[model samples]
Target: MDDKMHELEIRIQKLTQVHATDRVRQLISLLIKDIGEKTDASTIRIPCPLTTTDLARMAGTSRETVSHVLQKYKASGKLMIESKIITITDPAFFMR
Candidate 1:
């Protein structure tokens, strides 16, 4: 990988691990939490919502995989989809 990609990977790994890097760990956590609260819940059926396409991009997974997860989530009564808007029916479902 290029230096920039390598650097980003190292940063991500470090953040995922001990989170000792103050700038990356705490700052990113707060920002992400805020985003989760404000993001539209209809897109992916979760309160931390994302459109399938956007999610595909973010997770480095295919749109099909995202759709599959949504379908499974709906089937398990963890989510509700209406007019392409997904509502998180159970907030603690993922914890299980």
Candidate 2:
């Protein structure tokens, strides 16, 4: 019972931390939770084939927003997207 309450508390905290205006953070959290796997010390790979629409659905946002955030991450060297594969360049960056 205590453990379940703690888990619920953590979940509530995560949901509370995500604001409607912070779509990028929401998307990042969704991606990391859904498909991210630690490949090495500094890298995480999202091997599942996912489209912008899929990401939008998972993140509860629009396809355009997902595309925009992905582009920004690509430009910032935070993530790479190629043929549906997503590789997070710096896993620690998203852990926060």
Put down candidate 1 lDDT per residue, 14-85, tens digits, no spaces: 444542223222322332434434235532233444577765554445677667776776788766666655
Write out the backbone clash pairs for model 1.
42-86
Q: List the lowest-lDDT window of 10 residues for candidate 2.
A: 19-28
> So what's the TM-score on candidate 2?
0.72
Error of 2 at 18 (Å): 3.5
Give the top-scoring candidate (TM-score).
2
Error of 2 at 58 (Å): 0.9
Cα lDDT of candidate 1 equals: 0.50
Inter-residue clash pairs, candidate 2: none
Q: Kindly report which residue stretches of model 1 are placed more than 4 angstroms away from their true locations once superposed.
A: 1-50
Best by lDDT: 2
Score each candidate by Cα lDDT: 0.50, 0.74
